[model samples]
Target: MTQMRFGQGTNRITGTVVMDRRTKCLVKRIQPGQIAVIDHPDLDEVAAEELVENRVRAVINAASSISGVYPARGAAYLIRSGIPVVDRAGADIFCRLQEGDRIWLDHDRVGKVGESQAVVRGERLSAQTVWEKIHQTQSHFNQTVVAFMENTLHYAVSEKRWFMRPLAVPGMYTQLKGKQVVVVVRGTGYKEDLAAIYHFIKAERPVLIGVDGGADALLQCGWKPDVIVGDMDSVSDEALCSGAELVVHAYPNGDAPGLERVEKLGLAAHILPGMGTSEDVALLLADQEGAERIIAVGTHSHIIDFLEKGRNGMASTLLTRIKVGGKLVDVSGIRHFYPPKTERRRKAPLWAAVFSAPMAVAALPGSFTIDDSWLRMVWLSLRLWYFP
Candidate 1:
């Protein structure tokens, strides 16, 4: 384990174990054997793999939010891989506590700040300053990415022809009749979109659908998803198993890891395979399934959004959007203008009965635990068999 160090006050939340531009960019720039200070302490498997593979030593989570909420998948991956993580006492708070900043990590719960030795008036820290972040060292690497974007187009080639898809669609009015369906996605400005979802849900009782990482975002908001759709890589296993109906957004090439994960968890999923974007598939599912109104959250609507995701082509996405444009509602900022529609709340008892009526008749309970989980999962699958 590396010794703790502190320096300077910046207003961004500290003690988070996140892998952002700061960490990735810094890792590429620093010399072979120097400590890298990170403001956020969160990591996903891919980013965590990068840090460990790079042989960077010691990370200081600068904020409590990294510890308090959301899946610290990257941080957990680091710990599980034998990387040393110094808690909320890294660069963020250390700088703020200069001379006698009084480290207060819940003095009542943990008792007394800095139970370990304190280096008062620590050598003025350098590196890890927020204002000094950069993207890459190699201009060639920058050039390659720029070139990819310059050539990127927004149409899908089908049978030697190209087509465009709409990102938003107007759904059949019946889809929104008595239910709420909120599709959550991971995009730039997602926090803002999440705020919109929070307001929409409070005002309208729509079912929440997490589109891959957006599902994880919903969990952070304490909103359970009614359904989750996407490729499974960015989402956590816990979210996939969170009693939400899983819809595997299969690539036109027939790849659907999301479906496989759902099956592995003994849950049911519908494999909707098409070329285009995962969000596009999600909207199609809502429209095809007769969802009264599909309210999308965290969907990409601009060139920068696609570029950030490394989407070199937007043909399928554009065309998919056009296909579903009629029924889809852009609720990205719906809260600002439309007050949530008021309707009689569906009785909780009805939901309970729908979920429990089958369990009530089963003479044996534990004997069917495995089967129930499996059965509940495949319920939609079976429904597709009959309905399709």
Candidate 2:
């Protein structure tokens, strides 16, 4: 492994190097001030948000951070967060440096400290460059959209089996017959929507099915998922042990990577082979389980959402929606639709007191000595209520 020494008086950023070709896995081992070495090409905003939340000091990408195939906003997110990203850092670094090695990144050079030569030097991404590239890509956005639509249509036809036939869903311990099921995915505005329908969740007591990391999202909002399904990469071990009935999504070939992890942890998980994203499988699971109503929270329903994820084809998602179309309800802006139950219940008592105030005063004699100011406040409230 080659090392590089910076000249005195020059500011050198130093941290422990943690490398993972998979950005999601790297996030688990990254510390607040550590340097993340990732090989994610066209890094997406979701991965960037996770890296930022972990507070990594800097990022070194073995692949192009923004490949210009799409406007992946991850590099821009890191730049905006004041975290430096060195893109196209040669793949040699993976062989040159091991995890937990002390490294220094100075300008365009990166390697171990106190050595003369750098292991891998690469271009440092700037906010300006990333912004320019994004705009450049957007200039040809119509072409990308056209390609995406073409892919979607092609896949839709190829994966029509999901809609044509009954889905083979795995059995679960959680009962779903005649019940409302809320399938949660960690998509856009998921947290907000969850908060909005919190009252419905409490009152209706829907069966909660979380897709991978969505399980953690449920836990974060103080709700326990009745079932958790996905590839199991993004979810934490803590969530895996939360006693939710685990369902591992398998490929058509019956390969389930998540099932191994579950078994290693001494937990049993049912493997279901289906063609679609984990979220899609989750909705299908609810429908197949005879759920009376299937409510989806934070799912991808828009063209832009698929585009943002750099997905060319949404065949599985489209087919899944078609399969469960009658039962599925995509939730958005739920906060506007319903207020929290506590707020509504609290207002009921206040309104009752306001309406009964005059009767109470009438029942009491002049000797009761009601304050004039209190009467005026009551009159104002009644006027506002009746007039408004």
Among all windows of 10 consecutive residues in model 2, the one with the lowest summed lDDT is: 1-10
Tens-digit lDDT track of model 2 for 1-388: 1122222255368889999988878987798888999988888777788898888888999988777677778899888887888889978889999999999888778979777578889988788888998888778778877888899999899879655666566666789999999998877667778877765675578999999988987988889999999999888898899999999999877899889899999999999887878998889888887999999998987666686565787888888887788889999557666555566556665577656876867886576564676665666555433332
Residue-by-residue lDDT tens digits, candidate 1, 1-388:
3323232232111222223235545554443223344555333344455566665544445532133222234555555554444445444344443322223222111111544444221112123311111112232345545554444442344411423332232232224334556778776445456764564475467877788878877887878877777877667777988887776777666677667666777877767665567787777667656667777776876544554454654555666567667566675544454332232123233355456646654645566763576666555433322222
Name the candidate that leads on lDDT. Answer: 2
Tell me, by TM-score, which candidate is best.
2
RMSD of each: 16.6, 8.1
- The positional error of residue 24 in candidate 1, measured at the CA in angstroms, is 12
**Which residue segments of model 2 deviate by more than 4 Å?**
1-11, 189-196, 302-310, 332-388
